[model samples]
Target: MTTPLLTLDTVACTRGGVVLLENVSLNLLPGEARIVQGPNGSGKTTLLRTIAGLQPPSAGKLQAEDGAIAYAAHADGLKGTLTVAENLAFWASLFGTEDIETAMSAYSLLDLRNRHAGALSAGQKRRVGLARLLVTACPVWVLDEPTVSLDAASVELFADAIRQHLGRGGAALIATHIDLGLKAQVLDVAAFRPAHRSDGAFDEAFL
Candidate 1:
């Protein structure tokens, strides 16, 4: 059996010291994608954040190799002054990979390479952000609403990139409401929410 790239065993997640979800567990294996779904306040983002090591889990065991995961959140993490190619080159340099062609091509950013990221529209910027994932060379992807500003065609482009990533033996854990046409397993995090919402249990915005 193939070992999972990430594993969580009865994990619990918290925000602002209030436990939101517990008994959460899953394995993210190579070539697999898992879609995380739930209501607005049910901790979907929290679970993804915990797996990405952005914050500590309140309880249980979570295991993965150090630096094996790449996380993409609402923010594009772009520098306004840098051109699209420069941004990808910078990220690739950070990961010790110099090839940005594939990343640029994956999101159809070849034409926008010379354009400053700040000059692009929201959807174009979002594409550039998603393209950075390919340059990172990480085996695991942790995404939160990656399609925020993407149009239908751009969404398909993103989906194709994910398929290619999976084909290369990478895995993904995504939090999204829209279907990207991948045969991914679904994890409904609502099942893990605490029965009673404490006064301290704030929305994910606080995270």
Candidate 2:
């Protein structure tokens, strides 16, 4: 059997003394794509953040094979001062990868290479952010609302990129309200809510 890329065992989170998730568990395997869906305030973003290790879960465990993951959040996280190409090059360098020109072309950002990211439109900034993912060699991607601000054509482009990644044996955990036209296993976070909070801890009944 193939090794799973990610595993979450009884994961839970609390912020400002409120429970976000309670005993959430899931696993991701190679070449599999999972979509996380929930209404606002359902702890979708909190779950992604916890999985990315940006925020520690208040309970349970998250396990990964190693350093084969890339995470893209809702905020573009681009440096406004840098030109599109400059930002891509910087990330590529950190990943020890080359082919910046090709990566930009794939994301349809070749024409905007010389433009400062801050000066770009919202959709353009989002494209630049997506371009950074292509430069990384990581095998697993955790994307939060990747389709935000993208036009229909650009959305299709992004979907094609994701398909290619999965076709190459990469796995993804995407959190988005908008559909990206790719088949994905779905995880609904609302099912894991706790019945009550007692002594600042989530009730274990939901687990």
- The backbone clash count of each candidate, in order, is 0, 0
Give all TM-scores, in the order shown. 0.94, 0.92
**How far does residue 187 in candidate 2 sit from its true spot (Å)?**
0.4
lDDT against the true structure, per candidate, is: 0.92, 0.86
RMSD, each candidate, Å?
2.6, 3.5
lDDT of 1: 0.92
lDDT of 2 by residue, 1-207 (tens): 988889999999765567878999988888899999989988888888888888778789989966677889989889999999999999999988987886798789988999999899999899888888889878889999999999999999899889998998898999988878788988998887777755344444334
Candidate 1 scores a C-alpha RMSD against the true structure in Å of 2.6
Model 1 residue runs over 4 Å out of place are 198-207
Residue clash pairs of candidate 2 = none
**Candidate 1 lDDT by residue in tens digits, 1-207:** 999999999999987767889999899999999999999978988888899898988789999998999999999999989999999999999999998999999899999999999999999999999999999999999999999989999999999999999999999999999999999999999899877766654574365
